[model samples]
Target: MRKLDNNEDGNFNKKISNSPANKRINLRENPYVARIRDETESMRAYINYETAKEQVRRIDDAKDLCDEIKKMSEDLNSNFYSNLEISNSFGDIHLEDIPDGLRGSVKYIADNTGWSYLSVLLFVLLSIAAATRGRYIAKINDEWLEAITLYVIVCAESGNMKSNLLKLVMRPHESFENRKQAQHAEKLSKSNNVDIVIAREIALKQSQKNHGKDLVICKEALKTLANNVRHDRNMINDYCPVEEASALPRVFTEDTSFPKLYATMQDNGGGSTFASAEGNTFLHLVLASRSPLDIFTKAHGYEKFITETKRDGTKILQQPFLNIGIVVNPDIARQLYSNDRLGLHGLSPRFAVCFGGKQDEIVEDNSSKSDYNSYSEKIENLLEDNFTQEPSRKLIEIQFSPEAKEQLLIILKETEKEQNRTPKGQTHYRAYLRKIRGLVARIATILHIWGHAKPDNHFVSKNDVLIAKKIVYSISLHAEYAFSANGLSAYYDAQKILDWIKRHRHSFFTSTQVAKGIEKMKNDNIFPALDALEKLNIIRQLITPSKPRLCVVHKNFITSA
Candidate 1:
């Protein structure tokens, strides 16, 4: 009976293999199989690299160490992430530890956003976490209470639901504005406009003259006046009145000048979020006006930012609280970082970046509209509950427990090793590593608030520390991959070798066959080049543990042929 079953199974498989649908696999034309086959080639790439390294060592070359360095760089550029999958490199950890109130909503959006919901959640929570900026502090040790505020970047491609998620999660800020506007209209309806204009002029003059405590009185007077008389076309940096500026009435903005940002934070008591769904929306403006970067880099923490304007040498002092999130796709990322200004200016190190491949397809949800509505409502409720907290009440501080402190140090040391192991020419990698430990601390604070709605706890728990480390590790890996995307053009040279395999019309080929087919490529470069092409999923090798490996062309081998 077993023999008969085996024979039947083998004949059934043989019939399927000879079918028309399966014929494309033989021609290497089916993309789905091509993707699965790429994973196998990835392994061959690592083996080839090791084999080449061994051979390179055994050779007594006339070339010096500099020549070897150049060759090594070329090899790394061609097969950057082939050896390790960035997705699973960090291993797994528990991601279901979201606050019970927000869990269903988080999962609902995660189902449809076409983004890693975890990534989306991190961005969303950090935006909301801005409220806890100076209100709650952390004690790493016995010395001081550390203010925890993390700034994150969602580096995803366009049309990946970044904007939709931002719109959905950021509803409370808009709601708050609408509520406030109604209140303002009721109070200031019959106020005189001439009095307001006179008040603003007096306030500006007094601010310039005294730079003193009386400026507060002047600021408030101007704010009341400005609110009564609305100006649609307000000047840059002059958009908000000095008094009402920092305490932002409108919390979320896609476009804002540095002065406007400063005013928002100031009015909001030094705590607010600035988020850009598309990276290019603000980056182009930022790059053109370079001075804002200096202020933003320091304002993420409690440190005071003193910016001196070139226009009139006006000095602006701010000890503001700011949390910024930028969603950058590959095209914008390359353009932003390639100029080297952000790195050179020492600002790139401040952000905790979430970058990698974004989802290309949307996940379909067949759930009823009520289910979706309930999810959005829960998220809004979470934000509303937090936002409506007593603005004038005493609040307790948050800290890391002794064990959590030790755990944090261990994670810092792990990051330190990564910093040291980073190779030369990738100096920005070392620069960005400086902020990882700090970011971990801030993320721990976020989790603490997220897991427990109220800040009743004194110390961060062991679970929070564990989750924070996982977030850091993932971001660091993606950062390395994102910054190194520039060197990938070297992989294009592998196309010549792939074309040669196609021209021969052989089902399988050996190194000799490749050599015979390629009339132009030099003998010395052939093997190393073939190794790179294989790594890039341009070709594959049929595995035979006891026999010589045979070359199998990738399904898209003749793409440029």
Candidate 2:
């Protein structure tokens, strides 16, 4: 204001502003301001440069990370390619990692319409590839194609494409519209063909873990498959193992003849049945002999026989008639009886009036006493004749009493003399006597019990009784001789009766007596002797009877006498 300078006047003066030289000088002198300005400029320059450098560094790091990722991807690609190559070499598709085209086709058909372009394209490509590979494509009909397509779709949807393909290969003729349709179709298939169908159905139903619904579907499918492939040939009865089929016990009826029974056995492939050959039915044979059910069971396959019953309700011993009798072999009887023991009670008595035993009394009285007298005589005669003749012969004659008894005594005395000559003669003699006495007592007891009363007042009945008594006495005498001759007394001497019997059968005993003796000997431990006697034709065991029946050795006795 004092000088009226332009610089001070309304800021219009440029010449009055501080000079650059002066400001520079002033700035230099004031280090704080100068340093602040310098730092600010330097900071601006540094910020610009740092920004550019950071961008370069970021680009470099990104490029390195990308390279690492790319290398890893290459390694994965190589492994995948190697697995594909391995699969192709094997001519089998890796179902777990199926080709894109096949997978796409299957998926398309399963969820979408069969008209999926992707599926069609895949099918065409696969067909071409198969042809190029010299693999024959199955000539499938339109229906088959549709079914295959549907099956593939189901397989794809179920996530078991591999197994489904295997099923298709196994059963080329099989086809289905969908999984459900396939399952239904499988049921109609033959049993032999069911394997493939079942596999496919299982695959369709398979989840993370198999469960109830899957199991049910699988079972049904398997059953259906079985039906489709079942063999239609009739079961071969001829070749069918007899033991496996028709092995059921057969009960022969009274009306059934031997030839018919034999034929029946043959037809069923000839096997041992429980029924006895003595009569048509098991009960008949058992009743006729009054055999212990236990002894009857030891015969081959007797256990199976007892399971069957006769038409008559009679069993082995359940009947009133049978109740009085004691089973000699309870073990065998129980086996033969099985559950059918009570069924024997209904059988009719197989009695017939025969000549010889108290005929007049039997005719006049027709009483139980007369019946017993007749039966005793018949049985006694049968036993005597059976002892005298070979197994081939039919029993016909009975022996006289005194002669039979004397002959038996002579045989016994001779055997005793021979046994006493041995070092342990006394011991052998006592043991043998005990065995013979035991046998005689048992036989006597059985006879006395069976033949206690006379038939009736009839003289004819008395005559039969005498004859029966004589026959039994003779048999007992022979049994005595047999035991003594076989050195049965040697048990006390520590020498087996069986050993002596084997060595002396030909020298000391007649073939007839030997045969009878061997059977009696069986009550003791005389298996070796029995076997030897059988081999020598001194005795033969008739297996047809419930109890093994003894017969003489000679064929001539059987044929001539």
CA RMSD per model (angstroms): 25.4, 46.9
TM-score of each: 0.59, 0.16
Give the per-residue lDDT digits (tens) of candidate 2, residues 280-362.
24433444444344422221111222222354232221100000111111112222222233224311111100001000111
lDDT of candidates 1 onward, in order: 0.58, 0.29
lDDT of 2 at 197: 47
lDDT of 1: 0.58
Best-fitting candidate, scored by TM-score: 1
Cα lDDT, model 2, residue 98: 27
